[model samples]
Target: MRSIKPTHLRRRAFPRYLSTTTSAQPHIVPITSLLIANRGEIALRIHKTAERLGIKTTTLYTDPDASSQHASCSPHSVGLGAADGYLDGERIVKLAKQHGIQALHPGYGFLSENSAFAKRCEQEGVVFIGPPAQAMADMGDKARSKEIMTEAGVPCVPGYHGGEQGEAELLEHAKLIQFPVLLKSVRGGGGKGMRIVMEEGEFLQQLKSARAEARASFGEGGEVMLVEKYIVRPRHVEVQVFADKHGNCVALGERDCSVQRRHQKILEESPAPDLDNVTRLELWEKARTAALAVGYVGAGTVEFIFDKDTGDFYFMEMNTRLQVEHPVSEMVTGTDLVEWQFRVAAGERLPLTQKEIIERIQERGAAIEARIYAENPERGFLPDSGKLVHLRTPRVSEDIRIDAGFVEGDTVTEAYDGMIAKLIVRGQDRETAIRRMELALRDYEVVGLSTNIEFLKRLCRSPAFIAGDVETGFIEKWKEELFDPVVVNPEVFVQAALGVFTSHITKDAEPHGESLGFGTNSSERRFLFKSLDVLDPKGGEEVEVSITQKGNNLFDARILRKDEKAQVFENLVSSSAFAAGKTGLTTFFPHTRIETTVIEDPNNDNKLTVFQTGAKTELSLISPAWYERALGLKELRASVAAPMPCKILKNEVKEGDRVTKGAPLVVIESMKMETVIRSPQDGVIKKLAHKEGDKCKAGTILVVFEEEEGAATAR
Candidate 1:
């Protein structure tokens, strides 16, 4: 592949259609003008399809995302800062009216599942490019969707998808479903308002919490939880099915979304690995049936969870809009689902039959997609937000596709999803696809923020994944092996350490001097670093050394010794430092006391600070903007503060009321999760900043406390 800069790939501006063509062979109705109501990679993907179909596209973004790639995808773009516009239905409608936008496509999240939004679009004379409002309303609700599926002869996970949400009712239902039930919100997706109860003892507490979250997020309170059976050793797979206005529906294919975390899809692939022909065809038929049963139109996904052992699959949930991983299905199927969504919206019939769709998948190849997010894998996968300094992706081939909405120098904020881009690869087969993905990952690089790139690489090469023995618990099962770089392959560690060391040394070889020109000045030289470290076996701290020079493809560094000794490793650049060790790699980085593992490769004339006083200095570097403030504020406080941008649910205490530490103060909800604001200190409530439904943020004080007259301050 030729090395072409991203600028060279810039598409020519599209012109508005002068006229429409009519043919006898089910001529596809071309969408004239479209407005994308979401931001990020998915929006970018939809833009590409709209561009290819000669459809005029309009993209919207927030203030922080004004310069986002999605904004640049089309010629006509608008900046709708969340505070200024975007979510404001009236502003969006006004913009559409001004631009003469014929259709509105809610790409996946945000307003996609909002039935009222869809209805409003219909009322304002703009086509909603998704399932019908009635269909969305039915499927968007967990309980209603389950009832529909059950009536249609589709196997549903046993659950209580009915009545008002309550702790008493949900707990009773959970007891019937047995231990390890999933308490889900009836109104939302993306794992929000969802919680897993591992045992009966935690049912009531978790149920109450889940309901509070659902109420806060969806604006409808009560016990509207779906008490369902939690399937173990489950594989998350969904079928992409599309229907037209003429009552014809077809299933494109299936996508394996088994790789997940906290019940959210992270990695996805087409033609799920290890499935037999019978099972494969069965899934597709089931999807087709589900779509036809609901009289579904536009693009929709029928999700299901399969039991690897029994091969029993149960309906999970139906996403009423386009999915984030729809690109994978598109790559393998050789069809643009988004354009079809528009065609159907325009009252067109499906262009192809089920047989034709099946033949199409065979003509192309298998595809896999891995989502790259701005998160720290070592720190509980906490979201990392910061300005991206250097971003680069290798050449894109027929087999390689990248979907992104951010560029280098763009700041990732905490107010939105942490996704940066998607690394998608296609191959003649699964093995080839896996290998191509590995190469693509290595060639792809992003600097200035923490990400899960390394973690994904480890996952791509894992034995279970390679052998097609993956399930929903894949990440959890391989948590220790996937992360914890200290136990990395000796060869990989050696190579990475060498590469980083040599790059730095090569850059600073001239007069900046090795170690800031502090040559052999042991007294004046103090060094500190935060490389993935290894604990010392002989009561000494173990460390992974940062290499400074790449001599003949080998790392040249000094490995610290027990008696302050140094050793060298030469030519072995790919060796890993994380080998077998006593303790497992800890998830918390702050508490981890790992030392850098280094070895002397070249005889150094300059003094290097690999070890300091028989210990390694801690290096904690990450996007500080995304770090949770609550995790940082461990000091004394009379009352708890809001965790994020949210509204007050209900205050439990009144002014002048006495409360003990850890007692519930005010319930603040954000993104649907009801986080009970608790008192950090024992004192009498002096003031209440918020009432039953007040909007607040992380620093927004909920309540104030006064110390007892005779008691000293807790501090």
Candidate 2:
């Protein structure tokens, strides 16, 4: 890829459509070129709309994402070194000016809600395609937003949003609000900087952790914290509103974002299911009132925590920018919200009135969107970071939309959000939409790094979710079932073995020599037994697979257990009839067909990684002798290792420190979440491997503990 210098791209003359019109028509500021001030899927989303409007798009990327899919979509892109560069308002403004950008679109996250960044864009004479600076400042702070909502006649949760900033005062406020309160950073919006204190005994510790996280995430603004009464069994619902400079504002119904993990939304659907008409109308009315109260412009979301059983709702906070789940709203309303933001920023009146928007919502039906993240659900949903070797989404149709940030071969690094894509589908009703989403998730395949694809599928198919009985605590309530270990059927193991065996024979075959111990003579190639150890994400199992070659590219396979005699339980399979690609393989059996991707494990020549139906399994083709040797190897260890790549935030224990079982030895931060490493047993710390500020990879020992004398004997 050739690097294009910024100097070579100069400002060109504006087209007639973007030029100022002098007729009696409504005066509008023409924007011919836009600078996308964010990265990933949202940036690409904005560029698509900009291109449709005949606006040239320019994007800024971090060094790691310089060649990312979003970067490739834009005709002009500038490489910003790292996170700091992307958040540098002055640097971004300078680049926008140099590139002759007419407007700057902060595509959510990062500087999207930063009032200072918006002000900087305004100062640079570049249209900021969002709300005015004052609106952001008013609603950007959670505590302040609650006050504004209350003043605007919108119901707000009962809590302390006062100016007091002391820890004691906050604790006292929590006591007044009763136990089981929430300590949240006034400046925080995602799940970051938020903690739930369940009792008096845990208040102080929770407060300290929350404050530290707040300071790390929000900096100076994080110094102030707010205490709120925790709503039990609460449903997270937010209303999407759009406004224009012409004093017209319309609420585009509501979306239920209650399906969450760690307070971050994973699934969202528009026109909240099973909602009463009265409550729905009230939500929209209050949302409209709030938008008008702030003189809001462009797209924004007003979030509320609704008590499902009581039919009561309270204002939580307002996002003064486009949201991650805006696609659900777009799917149901048939509106391109990005285009709406651009037109509104250009001083155009809303294309539709409030009544018209509501009517459109009723006509368009239901839509649901499931966020596809590059994280492991079984491993405490720890975010995974690495290259995406192979990526595939469900077939795109009018009802199915795949908004992805990364592509095949792109890397999902630890420096950014783990969201790889969003699967959005529309249907005539909620049930239809739910079924469509489940099918799409099954079809989505991502190889190399772990993802929440399987978990999402289970969640979608869960009885509670399908029945629309969901809340913010849905995941917690069904944790056991959602994270249950996947049981790979014996058939799946046999299929994977055959896939690798066939691939190896085809690629490494000699004209007339023996292959896979199979003699060239047809009569002698009756049955070949291959003892294999198969490893899925959960665990590994050993089994003997026998195959009989019937003809060229044809074979019959079966699993042989040590205790039982080998028997063929399935019909023969012809490999030549199946579709096999470099990265993907399709196998056909008697009653079922399985599609999978096969990749040779680089570290082990005999091992192959197979991806089927969103699950990854590793197959190790080894002889019985090797399998016996592997089983005899001891795997016990005395060191506490990092579960994932992260920075060592703090070492709670030093060398020679005595610790009991489950004692936290160190704290590490990964993908914005902090995890503490705990001792596996009572022991003495023999060594400390890493220190604060050190970066460590998965399995890097952080602390080495020596078992107490006779500890193993005692166990």
Candidate 3:
């Protein structure tokens, strides 16, 4: 309800460009307050830049994100309903007007590329901090953009970008382009509404799925589709370009986004690795031409699919808005792109020329960015959504930058993308940057949900990645190494046990400020033996540990193996409780010091949650009697369940229908990806719970099966 104001307004120390023949410079629009039409990290990112420019920012939030970090980043926050609130253009423009917002910045998603929304802002007399509406319409559609690129002398991939909408006609074009062609929505971006048909037999099914996703994502413009040649093992690269209303355009540089999973980029770096000087220049030139052809007026990205083996690159599409990976480009160029966007939207000319931009890139060296997502890489990279019980980022440094959206206790719901944060690092060279990123990832920690942190670490250390041999299929090629189960070392478990024990003792002894003698010696107190059941992907291990005080904040800890021989391992270690309100313990050994985050179960104090090296280990301190009872319980039944909250698009079976193993039973859509739930065995459908168009939650059983007689059932 109250308007937000910047804490302080400081003039930026940048050169002011003078107008030609300065007889009172021409009128430039003044933007005092702006509204960011997006949410999460991007909203916070835009707000910070606006604050630095002495511009107040107003941010809109869905009901779930009403208390999110982004909402609090700006005091002028509006709570819109959960569903379709950010995407509602008219309401957003009205809110902007009510708050006296001079400009609107659509941060890289939602209505970022929607031309209608831009036109609406223009109609409302509010400046849109992006490209012109005409340019967005011309470049937002994949088919039209390819046509424009070809006219501008930019090489384009051979495909069908026709105006036909019939399924048969599109199928004919696919055949002409040959098998393994790509089906894409004309207005799609970020891998939505895109599918690859490897054979003719699977064309129609993929087309339907692609169309469904496109319709859900793009709405009105989703009716049209385009087909392209699916380049095998090509490098995904894009050039960042900026244009001013004065017709001056410059291409910053290229970012290699080849490492991907599910067609979405996970890693991106500036000054694409292994690119020849000649090829890089050509890429920049083509990108500039593409932007000029569209009369681009703000920040845009020209994406190209590059064949590394042949050094051939073709324009894929141009994103008519700021990209999510713009931070890496900024680090490599020593320029704040968001600031440029603000200035350009106010009808200001570019501060630097093409030559100056190139010089900055050369001086800044190399930079890399890794997107940290709350997803399970081993489970087909399926997105995970839940509350972040604990979150800790590495300390920010000159060379290291962390752009995060969520803090501790923030919930990662299924309403948006799974990305938690982006970790970017810069160095004097490429190898140094890679090593810095690895160390940064190891220092990053998040619990209460699955993440790809460990997977990113292995990827950075991969030999092929180090050699710069990357392609769009890099993750798929190295899936085995990247998805291998992590082996939690015994020392980590010991450290966790020590951390938990120390915290418990310190809490109990806080009131007296002295030892509570339960044993014969008053100074030396003995704690009961605590059995920790360590659970992992590999079975489980039970270790009985006991501690006795020896000196000030020093204790003798002993570990006994419950299985096989009663082997005893004893060591004298010094441990101390961390500060109040902190969730960790500090342990000092003879040669090493260990710091770990230890979370105890609120209901059961004996259980501990340890976050170590980006992986979570649940250690349940149990009694010998409870351990026996826990092991005797039977495991739950395996049923076909929804991986995430999604609407059932198709139901291929009914109750009592007998199905064979691997038969597709249902199709569900979530987060723009279609997952086909198939039968695990030949069995009769005992229960068909949901119908098409009905929404279901993750772990909700869609179909339950009763095994057929004499049929081999494998789960």
Best by TM-score: 2
Ranking by TM-score: 2, 3, 1
Q: What's the TM-score of each model vs. the native?
A: 0.73, 0.89, 0.87
lDDT comparison, 1 vs 2, better candidate? 2
Candidate 3 structure quality by residue, lDDT tens digits, 1-715: 1111112223333222212322443257868899999998999899998999999999999987877999899868998896579899999999999988899999999999999999999999999999989999999888888888877788888899988878899999999999889888998887888888999999998898889888888897785888888888799999999988776788888999999987889999988998866667767777888988887888999998987655678898999999999999999988889999988888777878877887898899999999999887766787878788667888889899988899998888877888999999999889999999998888877766678887898899998998899999898888777765555555555666566556655675421112355544643322222323222333446555455567776666555555545333344455555544235656665566666677665445556667665555666565445454446443334468886777898999988888888899998877656778788677888877898989988778888776445433232
Give the per-residue lDDT digits (tens) of candidate 1, residues 1-715: 0111222233433212111232433444456899999887878888888888888899998887777788788888988866335567678877898889988888888788888889889999888899888998888877888778778777777777778455676678778888788888778677777888899987887777776666645665434678887877889989998887766777888999999875667889998998766666666666776776776788999998787766678888899998888889988888778878878888887777777777788877789999998876654555566677556665788889888878876877656767898888888888899989877786655655567776787788898898888899898898777754433222333332343343334444422112434454321111222233223222213333434434333334444423555554543333323221111111111233223333221222121212211221222211122122213333334444554556788888989888887788887654334557677667898889888888764456777777454332221
Q: Write the per-residue lDDT of candidate 2 for residues 562-658, one digit (tens) a residue.
A: 4777756444554532233234556667687777666654434555566676565555655445454446443344677777789998999989889
RMSD of 2: 9.3
- Report lDDT (Cα) of residue 291, candidate 2: 80
Error of 2 at 326 (Å): 0.5
